[model samples]
Target chain A: EAGVTQFPSHSVIEKGQTVTLRCDPISGHDNLYWYRRVMGKEIKFLLHFVKESKQDESGMPNNRFLAERTGGTYSTLKVQPAELEDSGVYFCASSQMRTGELFFGEGSRLTVL
Target chain B: ELKVEQNPLFLSMQEGKNYTIYCNYSTTSDRLYWYRQDPGKSLESLFVLLSNGAVKQEGRLMASLDTKARLSTLHITAAVHDLSATYFCAVGSNSGGGADGLTFGKGTHLIIQP
Candidate 1:
């Protein structure tokens, strides 16, 4: 089975610009999560979605970042007016509701110059 | 807030040597997970310790958890060059389900040389 897949493996944008990253989870998976790693530091949790519903978004850094899972299949994370500190790899993970073994995707590397 | 800390953030060892990486969390958690990541690669699930005294082993790596101490250890046995990668330990906020976000430690970067 195909694991989680993310789009725009790498994205470069100027400061104050906007970028959207997409993730496609494995089929029938009910849970999707977003995490970010900055400057080779610890990977921090961002948010989680359970079948199109936002279960916990407490990890969202700020209002500038928005994540959505419209139909419960794929999810998107959008950063508006990206800042220099936003340059890092954003990883998307998925798992079943009952089983918590998360499967991660090749991260979307964002560079804000 | 839950916090996870990993010690020996960087390690360089020769082949056939053995080393252990430690993970400690500040708060009580229900599950702990170990992951491996090579340079520029995605996080790969290594082991998941669900309860206290849980131990899981695969190949040269073994991971164990002690809930009472809020500590987990990843032991590498007879390390090889292929074992060089960054290892991370994460704690889940809730119990057995996939409803919570994980708090992760700064990864331990391991280098096993020949």
Candidate 2:
């Protein structure tokens, strides 16, 4: 079976530019999550989507970061007017069961200059 | 908010030796996970500790969790060159069948020299 896949493995944008990252989870998985590792910090949770619903977005850093999962299939995270601190590796993961092992995608490394 | 700390943040060990990495969390959690990430690679699932005293091992890597102490351990036996990677421990916030974002510890960068 194919694992989770992310788009544009690497992205570069200006400080005020916009960028969007996409994630396609394993087929039939109901739980998808987004996490990030910024600079030298720990990998932090950004948000989670359960099918078409936003399960938890408490970790979203700010309003500039928007995430959408339409039709409960794939998801997208868009950062508008990206900031320098937003440069990091964004990871996407999915699980068939909520508490089961999560399958992760190759992260999208964003570089905001 | 839950806090997870892992130490030592770096480990350099010779092949054929043994070493242990530790993970400690500030809050109570039944779901603990271990993941590995190679340089320029994504995270790979290693172990998931569900309850107190849960133990799981694969190949030369063994992971154990003690819920009472809120501590989890990853033990490497006879380390190999391929074992050099960053290891992370995460605690889940979800209950039942819901998805909750994980709280991860700063990764332990391991180097196994041959």
Candidate 3:
């Protein structure tokens, strides 16, 4: 089976611009997660979706960041008025069930200048 | 909040040498995972430790978990240059029936000089 896939492997935009990253989870996987790693920082969780419903979103950094999984299949993370601090690698992962091993995508690298 | 800590934030070893990376978590967890990431690449799963005293090994890498102490270790036996990369350990909480988010450590950067 194909693993999780992310779109626009790399994204570069000016500060104050908007950007959207997409992720397609593995087939039949109900758990999808979003994470990002800033320069010199560890990977941090952003949010989670379980079959179209948000399971957890406490890790969202600010109001400018929004994530949604409309069909519970693919997910999108949008950042409005992106800032320099938003430059980092965004990773998406999916698992068959809660507590199962996660399969990760290649990640989307966002650079804001 | 759950916290994961990794020791020796960076390591440089010679080929044929052996070393171990340690991961310590703040609270109890349903499972622990080890992942490897090469420069500018996404993470690749290495080992999944599901229970206390669980051990798994593949190739030159081995991982073990000690739920009682909330600790996990990744041991590299006879390291090679190809193994140079950053390693991260993640702890999964029991919430959502293991569906909860994971807390990851800062990661260990391993450099093996051949």
Candidate 4:
């Protein structure tokens, strides 16, 4: 099976601009998750999706960040009015079972100037 | 809050040397996972420890978990240059059937100088 794939491996945007990152999980995988790592920081969880439902979103940093998983297939993360601090590497992962081993994507590097 | 910590955030050793990386997690967990990642690359799964005293070995790397102590160890035996990479340990809660997400440690960067 193909691993999780993310689009636009890198992105650059100006402060106050909006950017969207997309992730396509493995086929038939029910669990998808989003994580990010800022400069010199550890990777942190952002949200999780089970099928088409949002399982956990407590990790979301702020309202400017939005995530959606429609049709339970792929997911998207949109950052509006991006700030300089938002520059980081965003990773997407999926597992066949909930809490199981996760397969990660190459990650999308976002640079907000 | 669940917290996972890995000791010796940075390690540099000569090839053929033996070293161990430690992972400590707060609270109980369902399982512990070890992953390797080259710089600028995605994570690669190495081992999964499910129960107390569970140990798994692959190639020159071995991972063991002690649930009672909430500790895990990744021991590298006779390391080689190819073994250089960042190692991460993740802990998962007992949310039946994998409903929960993993909490990861800060990761240990290993360097094996040949």
Q: What is the C-alpha lDDT of each candidate?
A: 0.92, 0.92, 0.92, 0.91
Candidate 3 reaches a DockQ of 0.64
lDDT of 2 at A29: 97
What TM-score quantifies how close candidate 2 is to the native fold? 0.96
Worst 10-residue lDDT window, candidate 3 chain A: A95-104
True-contact fraction for model 1? 0.72
Q: Which residue pairs does candidate 3 place in steric collision?
A: A99-B98
Q: In candidate 4, which residue pairs clash?
A: A98-B98, A99-B98
DockQ of candidate 2 compared with the true complex: 0.69
Per-residue alpha-carbon lDDT of candidate 4 for residues A5-107, written as tens digits (9 for 90 to 100): 9987999999999999999999999999999989888888888899999988878899999999999999999999899999999999998876467899989
Each prediction's total of clashing residue pairs, residues at least 3 apart in sequence or on different chains, is: 0, 0, 1, 2
Q: Write the per-residue lDDT of candidate 2 for residues A1-113, one digit (tens) a residue.
A: 88999998999999999999999999999999999999999888888898999988988999999999999999999999899999999999999876799888989999999
Model 4 RMSD, rounded to 1 decimal: 1.8
- Candidate 1 lDDT over A73-96, as tens digits, reads 999999998999999999999998
Q: Each prediction's TM-score against the native?
A: 0.96, 0.96, 0.95, 0.96
On residues B14-35, what C-alpha lDDT tens digit does candidate 2 reach at each position? Answer: 9999999999998878699999
Question: lDDT by residue for model 3 over B1-114, one digit each (tens)?
Answer: 788999989999999999999999987789999999988777899988898999999999999999999999999999999999999999987755434778899999999999
User: Model 1: per-residue lDDT, tens digit, B66-102?
Assistant: 9999999999999999999999999986543433789
- Positional deviation of residue A105's Cα in model 1 after best superposition, in angstroms: 0.7
CAPRI docking class of candidate 2: medium
What local lDDT score does residue A78 receive in model 3, on the 0 to 100 scale?
98
List model 4 lDDT by residue over B55-114, tens digit each: 999999999999999999999999999999999998987744433668889999999999
